[model samples]
Target: MKKLLKVLSILIFISAAAFTIQFYFNKTHPKIQVELKDNALSCNLKYSGLEGSVDFTKDEKNNYYIAYKDRIQVIGKNGKSCDIMKDPVLDIHSIDYSKDNLYYSSGDKIYRYNLKQGKNTVLLKNIPNYGDYKDSLLRINGDCIYISIGSATNSAVVGDDNKWVKENFYAHDVTPEDITLGGINFGKYRRGAFQSYNTRSLKGQIVPKHFPGNASVITYDINNGNSETFAWGIRNINGMDFTSTNKLICSVGGMENRGSRPVVGDTDYIYEIKKGIWYGWPDYSGGDPVISPKFKSVKGSPLQFVLDNHPSTNPPAPLYQHKNVGTLGSIAVDSSGNLKSKDCIFFYDNSDNMIYSSRGAGSPLAEIELGKNSIISSMKICDESLMILDEKEGYLYSIKRGKVNAGTEIGRNIYLYLLLTVILSIILILKNQNS
Candidate 1:
């Protein structure tokens, strides 16, 4: 009986020791599979407290000029910093550098700042406001600047307009044709006092006979002072980049309100934009047309049509599904111009409050979780490393690709093996004592 009890105790001890050793190893092991390079450039957050969007431009000298809100900050190669312009007239949103000057935009006005003289010249002004213009995500493609304009309203207009019309007098079941075009026009009334307030509210209220909302891609010519809509029907796209195939890829946001529901499962889209092509907005989201009792529609209404309504005419699907992950901020392409584990798009996931990398091809590769206080505003590829801007701290973080440190990995493995051996020895001694 005594011998049997000793054997039982030894077996129990071995099992417990093995579990403990395994648990400790699991906790310490680095889960990241890809290696990161050691010698990489990193930047500390030099400035803070700027509202609005920010962008960076690199000069031939390799100096980085950062444009934020209303100022331009130049960071020297030696990590020295200087604000070239202070209390500037324009509210700068995006900036780019040419050979001798820096170009930026405030509203529809584009300005060029001479790096040597610090003089500001308006390159273009009073560029038409087409409701959904987001200056920060503006792109200077070839000879023109491409800006996205989103819809002005939550959804398409619906219902009758007579203020005096008794609620009961209006038949709840009005025919679709009777109310389709003559709904209550909310146009500029929704556009309140402030410009941002007006834009975020008013622009998409009335459906223009030709272009629905003023939402469009306005292309501005830097050499010739002319601008026009390159494409239309985008609700509120924040990210745009060109693929290796030279196809203009954009991340398009979805409609705000559908029926009485406030954006439940609307799927945002990534489109390979073609000239003059209209992506369905205010009409459909994620191949599903929005239906509302308030709005009347004709037979060919996007809502009335099913996914199979026009098999060949389906709206482009999103490369990935972020059902309610909130807004997708920026997208970058890899060397091959494809989105893969290496060629991935890094986006700020507001839902998870983290930076997630989707390898434009397969599953998500990695995630860098941030604290509650940290908010990532923008991301850019700087040489071999990836730089992310933390808006809250005004800090820039650089990430590089390299192998796991040999010393660190080997040390971890040694510790794990030693722990396992010690546990096994303890069990063996217990067993021998029982025998």
Candidate 2:
């Protein structure tokens, strides 16, 4: 009887010890499975317990500024943090740091928060935010701040696919340039492109260009305060970054199968952005027209071109196509030379919870796996360490070369958990043998 009590005490002690270590002391040491390359990397859990954090940026002083839905906070190396700005009304989307200012988008406005003066001033306003793809991403490249605005609806029409119709009935897609519609109405309301859900259009009806319109990358000059469309017809660019060669690259999400103009077998893509170029959307996917039989719905009729004419019928093709990747987000170029090449880029797959390192190829050289439950919202390479924010797990993981931590901490807790269980089983077996 006393042997049984002794065994129980030992098991209870082991359980308590493991719980304390996992919750308090275990600073998750993760691993990177670099299957393609022979690169030795170290992954570490830099920060944890951030639930609502959306995006983050680092300054020259190593201070990490993280943006949440309601506030933005600056955290130091010592794990201490304080809110730099707070607003309950702000639904902050993306963030970028340049010089001494941090720029971010919230709702329909972009604000620049100056670090020296501790003030945030509105940089731009009236961005279209009343649609399905409303995340406005901004990146600072030299004197140009490139901002991406998403289309208001799927394939230009505000049909039953839009859940925002109940709240904003009159909201629909806007054009960056004047476009002549084909006058094809969708759904029972017979709504057309560039109009409200209840409105219709005639053939050759012109939709004038609106400033800061959807489906475009707008470049705002910091010195001159001038903004112009850099490129148009980008369906929904969730990720944007400049390569080491000063070329802009974006990860664009393709059309889904759940819209009025449902496009089957659509795949997300990465594109090299060129100034004054139009990457096709609504009427095209990956530079191919939607009228192609490949885009036809599985059970429904074929898709027809919605535009009477296009700015450029021959748009540039995608640099890389991510087959079966649901939505790609947060692209980062490795300018720090930590990877094999300076031009190597890393992007997140929101559906698969994996990060891939690619050099503009159809297949990735290596992939960073964060399991199935992780939702990597944003990632960047800073100080030679790749910093990734897992929004679902509420942790910021860092990956570097062999210069930092000695071992990988990926699944380290599970190893300990299993080890304790094995020890308990052995003790129980020996106790039974003696009895």
TM-score of each: 0.62, 0.86
RMSD of each: 12.2, 4.5
Query: Per-residue lDDT of 1-435 in model 1, one digit per residue for the tens?
Result: 676566567667766776776566455432322222223322223334433437766777879877778788888888778889876556666677775778777765777789889798886664433232335356666677776655433343321231212432321111111112212223333321112221222323332233212445667677786766676655666667665455666766765433221344465556667776655554556555555443344332233321122212455555775545246666555535222344466666655566666655666544566556666666666565566666655555555555435644654576566577667766766776866
Estimate the TM-score for candidate 1: 0.62
Residue 16 in candidate 2 has what lDDT?
72
Model 1 C-alpha lDDT versus the unseen true structure? 0.53
- Give the poorly placed runs of model 2, Cα more than 4 Å off: 1-24, 27-39, 298-301, 403-435
Task: Please provide the root mean square deviation of candidate 2 (C-alpha atoms, Å).
Answer: 4.5
Per-residue lDDT over 100-167 for candidate 2, one digit per residue giving the tens place of the 0 to 100 score: 89999999998999999999899899999779888798888898899999998877877777999999
Give, for candidate 2, the lowest lDDT window spanning 10 residues. 29-38
Q: Say which candidate scores most in TM-score.
A: 2
